[model samples]
Every structure is written in C-alpha cells, then in structure tokens.
Target: MAESSTARVIRLRPVDDVAIAAVDVAAGTGVDAGGGVVVARDDVPRGHKIALRALRAGAPVLRYGQVIGFAGRDIAEGEHVHLHNLEYREFRRDYEFGVDARITEVLAEADRDTFAGYVRSDGRVGTRNYLGVLTTVNCSATAAKQIAARLRHSGVLDEFENVDGVVALTHGTGCGMAPDGEGAAVLRRVMRGYLTHPNFAGFVVLGLGCEDNQIAALTRDVHMRPEVPVFTSTIQELGGTRKTVAAGVARLTEMLPIANAARRSRVPASALVLGTNCGGSDSYSGLTANPALGNAVDRLVRQGGTGIVGETPEIYGTEHMLVRRAVSERVGRKLLERIDWWREYTAKNGGSMDNNPSPGNKAGGLTTILEKSLGAVAKGGTTALTDVVEYAEPVTTPGFVFMDTPGYDPVSVTGIVAGGATVVCFTTGRGSAFGCAPVPSIKIATNTPLYQHMTDDMDINAGGIVDGDTTVEQVGERIYRRVLAVASGEPTRSESLDYGEEEFVPWHLGTVM
Candidate 1:
C-alpha cells in the first residue's frame, strides 16, 4: 500500500513466522525486535525473509508458517537461511484421502454468474474470437501456413476486427510416428484439445491424409464436432498441396464474419482458469513472486475460479506440503505417483531430478532441486490440493490442480495451457520470454532490478517484495487484478511481443522417430 522506503516492515500473513523488509537493511544494522524475533543474521535484501526465532540444525524452515524445508545447519536469529545452509530431507509422506475435506463454495456461485464470451453451441466459452488452421502432419505445415499467408494478404483479417489473428497450429511430429502408441496418442489428444478449445471462434482441420495419422482416424478419435463454424479438408481430396491451400483459403473467407462477431463482456472471476508456473527462478522467487502469486491463487479460488500449478519436477521435494492439504489422499497419492514416475523417467533417460536448477538458477542463488522446490510450491498458496492429473489431462476440479509436466519452462507451461488454463502467471528472476497459444501469459519479475531493466517484458514487479515497498498480499492483489484485466482484454507483455507461436512446444518423452 505505502511506497517503499526505509523503516517499513511487512508481514505476509497475520500468523506469519517472519516479517519481510520493505527496504534493504544495511549490513551490520540492528533490526528492531518487533513482536516477533530477529531472523536475518546477514545483510538482508528488502524482499527477503527474516527468522521469527533461533533455529536448530535440521529444524524445518517456516514461511507462511508452513514447513518449506529443513535447515541443513544451525541458523541464528536475524540470519538469512537459504540454499547454503538448507538441505532437502526425504521422509514418508502421510496422505489423508477424502478425510476432513472441504468442497469449494465458489463453484456454487459460478453456476449463476456468466461472462459474455462466445458461447459455443457445444456449451464451452470462448474468451477470444479467432480462426485456427490445424495441420494433420508435418507434411501439411507449409500448406497450412500458405493458406494463412494468403488470408492475411487478402485483407481477410481487416474485415474481422473482433477476431484475434488467425493461428496455424502446426508442429514437427505427426507422420512416421506410431499410429496407436504412446507418443502418437498424446499428440493426438493435444491436437484434439486445441481443435475443440473454446478460445477458437472457428477452425479448419487440414491433413495430407496419406500419413499414418490419417484425417479420418483423427476425426473419429477426437469426436470432431463443433456447434460454431468449422471447415475440414485433405490434401488428396483437394487435388494435392496447391489445391488444398486454395480450398482452405476459400473456406476461411466464408468463416471470417462468423468469427468476427464475438466480443468481450464482464465475466465473473470463476470463468478464469489461472495457470501457475515459475522459470529462471532465483532465491527470491519463493520468498516474493511465488508466494505473491499464491495469495492471488487463494483470492481467485475464493472468487470461484480455477488455479493450476504444474511442472511435476518442480514440486519434487515439497510435494508433502501439498499432500497434507489434499482434499483426498487419492489426490495426494496421484501427485506422489507422478513424482515417482518422474524419478524413474529421469533415471531411465540418463538424468536425475537433482539435475534441475539451470545454470541461471544457480547464478541467482539456487542450489538443488530440494531448495528450488521449496520456493516453487509456494505459487499454489494455502489452498487445499484439489486434484492431481496426468500430463495435459483436462482440469475438472475448480480450486487448485497439479498437472504432471517436466520443469522445462516452455514444455511445462504448454502442458498447463493444454489442460485448459485460460491465463498464466509466470514468475521469473533472470527474465524469460515465454508465451502460451490461445491462452495469454502474465510474467511477474522476481526482483526489482530485472523488472525495471525488462519493463517491456514483465507485467508485474514482484521485486517490490525485495525492495520492501509492498507486502506479498499487496503484490498478490496487484497480480490478481492484472489477471482479470488481461482476461477482459488487456494484452500481457508476452502477448505484445508475439512470444507464443513458435514456442508451442509440447513435451516429447521418447525419441523423435
């Protein structure tokens, strides 16, 4: 609330174990003993946390008064506890499935409130109006793009002011892949999801038709049906590539007006599905941006919305925290199963989860997966873990759901969006240029320096946490407001930069045959 300056202190929660500095405390300065104890023994930055009391070696470190991790060594009062002295310890996690559970009350309220989104006859809502060009295989990518290019040249978009840019959803893999196997199956499902995604006002499904992934089979598997506008084609049927492009363009010309008729209206927050992720993370991510977003997650959940925290590897050492808050042990165990799968997945792939924390993260003061995870999990806030899902599984539970995905920034985020996240809140310290297709991404800078330097890229300055200018809740509220604004039509920094199209990379587990 107040502008950042010296002599300001803020608490994250009423019962928080520590207070964060509103301004950077000089080295060797005596921090006044507030109602709580001094925790920082070193020169602490504005957004960093201080201890509430003396901590013994191996004692669990608390933030939001929750066990984020354990102190690897002794931590003195007023001393900073971070990567150097904290270690991740594995223990048997206790799961309480379906016990002492609370159903989200907001779902009931959302049943009544509605947004003026494009209500597809299929019963899904479209936040933005757009025409989509879908390719069945790599063989058809050029043709798909050519069709889109022709539409652009024809003044087609100029005629449809309400529609967003026509997007050609093409990728590297499709044919030469096994037709009925794992990779093919996953890719097929993802493609189906996009074809049917509520965001598209209209879509054209194009295929070379001779590839292993035949257009007939894909349509059958996806149950391809739409209440609004849709056009389908095959290269063989349209007289090959050149003829197919002409046909596709002709089809799009007719669909433009129908796509342009959609507009945005006041929508209740419940219609919002917020995707939570962090990238280029630093020591302060958990302390500032993550928790700040967590508060926003809680606020959204309170308002009858959905929040998804993905990146299964990022949640490695801190999953127990989520388990304890799980509405059902089944949900908690589902998360654990994913964690176990990753362990085996990495080992078989000649890697380990500990091999995370990219060079950038280490330079920013992060050490191991355990240390990074402590901060990573903070983005979920204090809500009960409502559900755990497989990669790109449609998120049905409203509050907070965890989707299995690798921690790779682009790949992980793609899974979150595919799972139906309408808006994404991404936290970064080293600055990342990431975007989501159909869905918009909101980037929050973890520290003030990066925020100011990359003002064009970052949407929110959670670095205020380190500057001692605002509390986590204040920044959280700021992010929450931005989510609503972006959902309602404000373009995020990533959207302005056109950072999502080529970055539509889905995670590939096996070899690219």
Candidate 2:
C-alpha cells in the first residue's frame, strides 16, 4: 500500500477504526479518512493512531483489520489514540491451522540467484571466513576477549587477507548455574552451533577449568570438519590470564594461514538462511520496514532459501496469522505449544504477555503489545510456516520457519544465528544498533527521519514507503539484492562499525544458581 505525499493520514484497511498520522497533525486540522474528512480533536504525532470515528468506553479499537486494544473511555472522532486511552486485554483467537498455506513457486535451478560463499567440508555455505574464540564460562570471558583482541589488533590478520576478523564470543552466564539444567543445555547447544558454524574457518573453546560448563563435556560427541582446527584451554590450566591469552593468540596465529587459505566460490541462493528480527520499533515499523523485510523474505523463499523469524513474545497477538499459514497441523501446533509455554513462562515469573512495547517503543507511538505484534509478524512475509523449532535448535527446513525465542533483540538474534542463519535483516524504527558476528546483519530503518538520523548504521531506507517515495516491493527487492551482496562479502554498516562482538548473548533459562 502506497500513500501520497500530501496524505495527512494513512488508513491501512477499510475496516480500520483508526488511521496513522502521516505527519504531526495539529488539533482542528482536517484530515481525509477515506470515507470523509474528519477534523482532528487533538494533536496526533507522526506514527501515532488517530481515531476515525467516535467510540464508547469498552469499545474495541482496530487496525490492520484486527483488534489492537479496547478504549479505556469514550473517545471522540479524530482523537489521538494511544496508551492514555487504549488498554490491552485477553481475547480468544482461532488457530485454523494450515488455512492459508500456499505452495511456493521455487525458481528453476538454472534461474536461481547465486552468491560468493565458502562451501565448507560439511557441505554448508559460509558468508564469512573467520577464526573465533568461544568461551565456556563467564569466568573465562576476559581471557577470551584478550586473546581475540591481541590477534585482532596485532596486525597479524593483515597477512591473511581471506580472514574476516577474529572475534571472542563471550556471554554473561555460563557459570553459576546447574550443569545438567535447561540453561546449561542451551549454552552448550549454542556453543556447539558456533563450533560447527560454516562462518568460522576454525575456533577455540576457552574455559575456566572449574566451571560447570567444562570444555570436555561441551565438546563431547560434537564434531567439526576435520579440515577445521580447534583448540581448548582453561585459565587454570594455562596458569593465569596473561599466559592463557598468549597461548590463545599463538594458536590462532598458526591457524590464520589455514583460515586465509579458504576462498569464496559461487553458491546458490538456497544456501542462504536469512534471519528476520525487529527492534527499537515504532508504529511505522509495521507500515514500512517490517513489511518491506517480509517482501524480501518472500523473494528469498521463492529462490528455495530458508527464512527464520523468532522473538516469540513479540508475535503473541499475530501468531494466529502464522498458525494459519503453517504447512501442516503439526507445525502449527508446535508453534501454539511454544506460545502456551511463553504464557506459562511469563505468568510464573510475575509478568504478563502484555509486558512489552518498551519505553522507547511507546515514546515512538506504539501503545500495546498487540499493536506491536501485528507489525512484528510482517517480517515473515506470506510464506508457508514449514516448521517451528526450539531455541538454538538447528533449522534445516527450507522456506519460512519460526523459532521459539524471547523478545529481547540480542537473545532473539543469537538464537537465530546459532540455528544457522547466514545473514540477518534487522528492522528498527527507533534505530537499534545491532550486529551478529560471522553472520552479518543488515539494518533497515522504518521512517525517513530515523534513516537520515542514523545513516551510518542503517543499510536501507524502507522509510521511503511511508514517505510515498517508494513502494514496499521496491524496497524489498533492494533488501533482497543487498542480502545477496552482503552474503557475497559486502560489509554491512554494522560490520563496518565492528558491532557484533558485544551482542553475542545466549538465552539464559532456569535459575542463575
């Protein structure tokens, strides 16, 4: 849906009870509401909702032709609709599994697009060739960081041109938890995924020796390509932090030439596993960036590639839409099961599913989690939900799939990347600074103002859609092409700023003790 530059407000659906202000609309301004012009009763900030008609207290408000919230009190026509008057409440939805699962037309092999990538010995493709330092416990984080830092800043990488960069993948909670509990299992799985990740030419597993997450146990039965070298050490065994760092740097130094020997070759687009996520969202997120990213996801699916959309909590209200698109009842049911799990998970933790749409989101015009979810699910596009996997689980299904993950941006993205996403497309209306190492993240801004404000961080301006300067398909095709180019070794804005190292967060489940 495109809008005219002169449009004062945008009505997403004919049945929508509200319209989004295209710009800051002052009180008494007459705005066209499709059916007729309505005088604004109050000032409506850009991206905020404006009621199209008066409604009594307890009346349901709709947007995108679905219920977003209920009115807290009587509202006048053209009144600003936001948190002060809108409130969230539980409502039932029909799952209707497989109701809209359409068969995708996969591009013919001869016509499929290709990108330059490194084909690993295990037959997986990698968009980057890098040596990584993996920490088994938080106690070893400093040593891990020092090791990666020494190699990265030593100018040693200058000799190995094929290497992308050495990175230390550290986390905050590998210890102070049960060894055989859910949290430990998740940590181990994430570490294993990175160990076998095609993005890394090789990696070292660093531990604190006395932590519950021991290197021996973590690597047990885990296999890496024989051609890929791996080393394991502990601060205790290495004597101290300085010695551990020295040993790590020396070992990785020897492996740099081996890593540099790997070269990129043309691979089919099917080799790409694109992860979709949105953060720092505003009302325009649904209108612009998210839908545009969804369009690109559709294009990738048509090429026989995989697309993973997670952040389970953020999709609460719109899950029924995804459920209907599931390719099978089993896949749809799995998604609902995860949703139920989150409901119980949040309830037991003294929280409600409605505890979302952060302060930044509200400040940017988002009101409720329901409203936020409607926009969030647009990142999946109109593709069949081929499968739903647990957090950090391997994503082998082609086409679009869902993963169970928290709404926190870093944790959600870490799960997606761990599940084998070779590239990520992150949409932001409030300008989220994020990156996932090894797998590059492409940032798309939801509004022209945010894009122009953070030009250095944003990769594409999907905001053009809201500006009436471009269509969703146009921006989507641009995003899809950018994905290919980035997969072929083009540095994304995030990578250029070296933003991925600090964002390596793993989902922490169960008690810290």
Candidate 3:
C-alpha cells in the first residue's frame, strides 16, 4: 500500500483490516484509509494499530496479511485494537513441507563480496582475534575474569595490535546441575563451541577441581585442535584463586605474541555466520527492523554466507512459514519436534507459552506471544531452511538454517554464537543494548525514536523505513554491508560501549541438584 507523503497511518498490506498508527492519534483524529476517511474513536499510541473496519466478537483480526488474533469483543472502525479487544487462540497451521523451498541464485565467487579477516592456521576464517578465558564452573568465573583482567590492567594487549582484546567468557553454572544428564551435556557443548570458535586465537578453560565440571574432565573429553591452543587449570590444584589467576596470566602472556602475530587477509563472505534475534520488540519490529534484517539475510544467503534464525518460542505461531521453506520434510519435522518440546516443557513448569509479551511488549502494541512470534519470524528472510540444529550444536550448513533456542535474548544469542555464529545482528523496537562478545553484535533499531534515544548503542536505524524516509531494501543493504564491516574488524556501537561482558548466559536445562 503506497502511503501518502504525510500520512500518519501505515497500511502494511492492501488486504489488511488494520492500519498501524504511524504517530500517536488522539481521539477524533481523522485519517484516510484508502477507501474512505476514518476518525479515531479513542487515543491510540504510536505503533499501535487502529481497526480499519467493524468486527464482531470472535472475528479474526489481521495484520501483515495474517491473522494476529481474534476480536474479544465488537471492534469499531478507527478504535484502538490491542490487549483490551484482541485475544490469543490456538489453531492448527498447515505446514506444507518444502512447499516454498527453492534453490538460491548464488552469486559467482569472483563477483561475490569479500571482507578482511584473520585466516586461522586450520583454514578457518576469523572475524576477530581475541584470546579467551573460559570457565567450567561458577566457582571458576572470578578466576577466569581475573585472568583476563590481569592482561587488561597490565596493558599487554596494547602491544598485540592484531589481537582484539582478552575476553573472560565466564558463566554461572556447571556445579549443581545433573553431571551426566542433558544439562551437563549442554554445558560441555557450549564450552567446546566457544573453544573451537574461529574468533579465539587461543583460550584457557579453568575450573574448580571439586565441581562436577572439572578442568581435567573437560580436557579429557574435548577433542582439542592443534591449530588452536587450549590450556587448563583448577583452583584447588593451583592452590587458590590468586595462584590460579597468576598461572592463567602467565599462560596467556606466553601466547600474546603468537596471538598478535595473526593477521587479517581477504576472505570470501561465505566464511561468516550471522546470528539474528529480535528483543524488546514492538509492533513496528515486524514492519520495520525485522523485515529489513530478513532482506539482509536473503542477501547473505545468496552470496553463499550462513545466516542463523533461532529463538524457538519467538517463532511459535509463525513456524509453519519456516517449515514450508524447509529443504526437506526431515528438516520440517525437526522444527515441529522442538515446538512440541517447548509446549511440553512449559506445561510441565506450570506455565503457558503466552506468558510472554512482558508488560513492555504490551505497551509497545504487542498483546500475546502468538502475535509477537508472527512478527519475530520476519528476521529469517525468505531463504530455504537448509537445516535445523539443536542448541549449542555446530551449524555446518551454509545457507539459512534454524537453531532451537529459548526466546530470552542472551540465551538465544548464546546458543546461536556457540553454533558458530561469528557475528550477531539483533533487532529491537523498545530498545536493547545486548551484545555477544568474541562475536561482535550489530544493533538495528525498529523505530526512529528508539534509534535516536539509543544512538550510542544502536548501529543502524531501520525505523527510517517506517518513517518512509527509506525503503526496506535500502536499509537491508546497509545492514548486510554493516555485517561485512563488523566482520572486517569494524567495532559496533555495543562493542564500543563494552556491553558484551555480563551477557554471556548459557541455557540452563533441567533442575538444579
């Protein structure tokens, strides 16, 4: 639907019965709805939707050309349509496997884009060369941080021009969870993922000797790579935290020169794996940033790059769209399996999937998780779903793939990063400053105000598309180019603000002991 030069309402699609309020519409505000003029019956917040026509109770409410929900009561034209009059309901979705799957038009290698990156000894291309300090247990978290702090405060990183920085990849689990169950396996998978990640030139995994996740066990179970140096130690064996920190510092000191020796060289865009998620989302998220990101994702996939779309819960109601694009029925069924798992998991915990859309989401024009999910899936782009991977598993497929993860921003991004995402692209409408280190994060804002308010943390403004200042493809191109720049060592806004430290939250499965 072509919006007028000064229109205050956005009809996302021609057939849609609702128009998103481009600006706050006070009661009695009049607007053109294409067929005729409509007047606001109540105050409607910007980003919220205004019904374009009358609806009887239980009638379907549509947005983005899909059913968002059913009207809980009679909805009058020009009235605010939100939590008060809309309600969530479950219905079967037709997931036609491989119905939309298509072979991507791959750009020729010589004509494809390239980015400057560190070429690891094992032939893996790296975006950033940082020395990592991983901890197996919460008890070792401080020691791990201290190790990195020792290098930071000492200023040794200044000499290592090629090295990005020393990062303490510490966490809060590994001691009380089931030592041999799925919980323990998940932690080990995450640890190994970070250890084998191409971004880290070298790393050390430290642990509390008495904890279930011991340093010795990690080394013994892990298949160490010759090209990547991995060292290990224990607080109990190293005497104490002070001694362990000293030992960690000494070990990393010995590796600084080697880390610094690494150099960036031209690499194909295929080497990059992008992880995308939307949090602090609002109604405009789907209409703006998320769709813009989806366009970028399609661009990356066409260029032979990998793009991961995760956050299983966030994709709940809209999953049939992805399942339809699956490369095979096996892949499609795998996605359904995870959806069932979440339903069961939530039920077991005495909760419902609709429990989300936290108060902030409601104020931002989202009513139910189903509505939020339908919008969130827009980040995946219209690429074939080549594969579906479990949480923390390696993503070996090249084009677009799906990784199962919770909707929690940090946890979902963590699993995606662990699955070999070297860079993260996060979209937000209400605003988010989240970042994933080792992997640089590029933030895309869904609204103009959010971008303006969080300019220091936002890297790109997709809101311009909403303001009709730019088109979706235009912002999408910027996002795709920004991903390459970040991979080539450009610092994103969140990286500049040092926001990746406390965001390293691994998914905790099962109950604590």
Candidate 4:
C-alpha cells in the first residue's frame, strides 16, 4: 500500500465495506466512491467515513478483519458510519495463533547497527540529552524547583540548546510510607529507572536530609554513577533550604556545557526503542490506533527495532494470546507472573482488574475488561513474544516485549522510559494532552473529530476506521511513517507546543503517615 496525504477522499480496503473521503462532502453530490456506490448522500468531510457496503442493524462492522463494533441501525451504501450509528457488541474472541502472524526476519549485521545516541556509562542508549534535578522527598520539591528555576535566570540554557531541559522530578509519596512493602518496591524501581535513564546528561540529588527515604539510600539503590557529576545536598547538610538550593544550582551550572555538546545524528531504526500505550480510550482505540500501532510495532521489529507495551491491568484476560506466542516458557511464565501479581495486588487493594473502563469508556461503548483486552492486545501486533520483564528493567530484546506496570498512564510510560524507550506513541480517544520528559511522545487520535478539536496535541488520526475512509493497515502504515519522521527529528504536536516541561511525573508509592 502507498501513503497519501489527508487532502482527499481515500478508500483503504476493498473489503473495507466503506470509503473515507479526505474532505467533507455534502449530501446528494453524486459521489463516485469507485465501488458502484452513487452519491446517495452529500457532505463528507476530510477524515470522515463513508460506507462501502450496506450494513444492517446488529451486523458487525469489520475493520482489520476484526469486529470493532456493530451497526446500531440500518444503513445504506455510501452513508456515514460513526458513533451514532454503531454500538459495541458483546464479543468473545477465539485465539487463532499465527493466523496472520509472521516471524521478524533479522538481517545479518542489522542487529549491530546503532543510533547516534548518548551511550550512558551504564550501557543504555538515550535519544535525548537532559540534566535532571532529583528530590528525595516532597519536602524538597520546592527547593528542587527553585534550583531548576535558577538555571533559567543564570543563562545556563543559552549555552546548552542540545540539552533538553533541567527537570525537577518530584512526587507526593516519598516519606511516612511503609519502607518494605509493595509501595516501597515500586517506588524504588521507578526512582532507580530515572537515575539510570540514558536521557539524563547529568543530575543532582536534593533532600530535606532527614526524610524516611534517605538521600543516601536513594543514591545507593538508584545506582548513580561515580563519574556522572552527581552532587548531593540535604537541608541539614547545607544548613538551610536556601543554601541547599544554591549548592544544587551551582553544581548543575557546572554540568550544563558538558550536556550541551551532545547532538543529533543519523541513528539506525533498530536503535529506536518505542513505547506503546493508550489512554482516554474508547471502543475505536483497539480497532484503529492500537492495531495501527501494532503494524508499526511489526515494522519496527522487522527493522530490528524494539517496542515496549505496558498497562498490565489492561491486558488481563487477553494475556493467554501472548503466552501462546511466547518464544520460551520462561518468558511466558514471567508474563503470567506479572498478571498473577496484579491480581493479588488489586485484590489486596480492594479492587479487581475488571474494575477498569472509566466512565468515559463505558459511555463510549466499551462494556467489560474482556471486551477491552481483546482490543488492547492489538497494540502488540502479531510478533512473537520476545521477552517479559518487571517494571523499569532494561529492555535488551529487539522485538515486541511487555513490561509490567500499573495501568496509570504516567506510571506506565515512566517504566517504558526507564527501561530505555527513546520515544513513545500514545493513542487516545476523547482527547488527551499528555506529554513526557526525556523521551518524546507522539499522540494518535482514535477518531477524526477529536483530532480536529485537539490538533495542538494529536499527532496522527486513526478515526478513518470508524469513518470507513481508510483501512487499518493503511492507517498502521501511516503511523509507521510518522514514527520514522519523529525519530528523524520532526517535532510532534506535543513537542511543538512545548508540552514536555510539565510531564515528568514519576510514580509515587507508599502512604503518608
């Protein structure tokens, strides 16, 4: 399939049962949709959908050859297909393993090619250069922010355009929490991931000095390198808050020029680590954006690249599909273990995995976790399950892999970035304005109108599926192309809007006393 711009009407698949026009057309315009459909109606807009075949009430509307939803009412050929005319049905999916699966053929020496990334002292590749300011507890958050704020006033960035920014990573749950429970363990994993993240050019650790999470323990557990220009200051050690902040700023200023020298150069696609996630999701998310992303995931794996899919609770019930594709029993076991962990974790916390599908999801037509999982799994595509790892563990395999993480958007993406994802692709319905620090994020809109309404944040639109204007494979290919463009330095919508600055939220575990 070839790529086309969003300037005209385009039909994606012959079996698509629909044709989507690029621009909106009015009714009774004698529309020639190329498949024996006359202009039965007018007024189709760009990115809107039109039917290719006649659909009856309760009949399934197929895209990507999967039932995305059913026709809510009878429709004629060449008519528009969207939310008003369709409703999600109760779907029971049978696993047809490898029915459409193909193994990723790794070419000789392809695995050895690398991107011109900042090879961290710890052996991870970073796609961005950033100087991070770490706070040991919420008590020091204002101080950490003050330190970062001082950099702007000091003309430090004037000499460091190559450096992303000086971000202060602070959270709400660092002290008074259980020191050795699930909360502590998750917090440690998240914190360690940030300290060792390749995107950081240099960092400074700050604290009130006497909080339960000692700066000393964080430094030890996070494994700050002896040579990475890490400076530490506690209010106690530095005599006061103002003094501590001053010390941190001074150390970061010294590291600025060193970070600024890092530059972007041609990097092989395999060096790309892609993070896959979906938020504010609706029924069309699994149908359009998710599968489209799956196609990009397949292409990246074929190019010897790596892609990571998180959101453990969201994948419940559909995990068996991945297990059947697992390359080793160990990998399968690891995945199952995470699922088991989530089950126990949620049970202890007085919830269930089925307690998902926010009010938005239910209103938008998704009924149950079973329904959502069948669609969510489409994000992984048809690749063999390469490996499974815990939160923030390094991703070394070159194909599709899963990371265990909370279903929360920020936390899940945090693990992906920590595990070394250089970029992220997020799919959303009902619009999302999320951004991430260190790694770049590209947002794909699940429906067309949402893309138009929130153009400031959306990078791609997968609504063509619902509009009957494009095929899933065609949209998938479009996403793949955008990935290459973003990797090659094209600024995504989030980047253009400077959304990265406020998005560096780390997961907080444990509870305040």
Model number with the top TM-score: 2
List runs of model 4 lying over 4 Å from the truth.
1-102, 109-116, 121-123, 221-227, 508-512
Q: Model 4: C-alpha RMSD to truth?
A: 5.6
Per-residue error (Å), model 2, residue 8? 1.6
lDDT of 3 by residue, 1-513 (tens): 434333488887777878888888888888776757788899999989888999999988888788888999999998999989999888778989999997798898997899998877666778989899999999999899988988899987888789888899888889887788788888888888888888988888788888987666566666555766777878998999899999999989888888888888998898889999999999899888998999999999989999999999888888888889999999999999999999999999998877778877889998777779878998988989999999989999999899999989999988998899999999999887798888999999999999999899899999988787998899999999999999999999988888776888899997788
Residue-level lDDT of model 4, residues 344-387, one tens digit each, is 97888898777877777755546456556666788898888888
Worst 10 residues of 3 by lDDT: 1-10
lDDT tens string, model 2, 1-513? 423334478888999999998899888888886778888889899999889899899998999999999999999998999999999988889889999998799999789999999999989999999999999999999999999988888998998889999999999988888999999999998888888889998888899999989898899968889999999989999999989999999999989889999999998999999999999999999999999999999999999999999999999998899989999999999999999999999999999899989999998889999999999999999989999999989999999999999999999999999999999999999999999998899999999999899999999998888777899999999999999999999999999999998899999998987
Instruction: Give the Cα lDDT of each candidate.
Output: 0.76, 0.92, 0.87, 0.74
Residue-level lDDT tens digits of model 1 in 1-513: 222223445554454444555567665555543453343458766545555567789777655455556877887776755567666665555555555345556655645344455555664555666688888788888999898878978886886788877778787777777788777777766777777777777788888878866777777856434545678878888898889998889888888877777667665778778899999997679778999999999888988788999888888877767788888778888888988888898889898877777888866766567667878998988878898988777787889888888888877877777777778999998888888768788999998888999999999999876676788999999999888877776788898887776666666655556
Q: On a 0 to 100 scale, what is the lDDT of residue 429 in model 1?
A: 86
Query: Model 2 segments beyond 4 Å from truth?
Result: 1-7
Looking at model 1, residue 353 earns an lDDT score of: 76
Give candidate 4's error at residue 235 in angstroms: 2.1
Tally clashes: model 4: 23
Q: Which candidate achieves the best lDDT against the true structure? A: 2
Clashing pairs in 3: none
For TM-score, candidate 1 versus 3, the one ahead is 3
Give one clash count per candidate, in the order shown. 14, 0, 0, 23
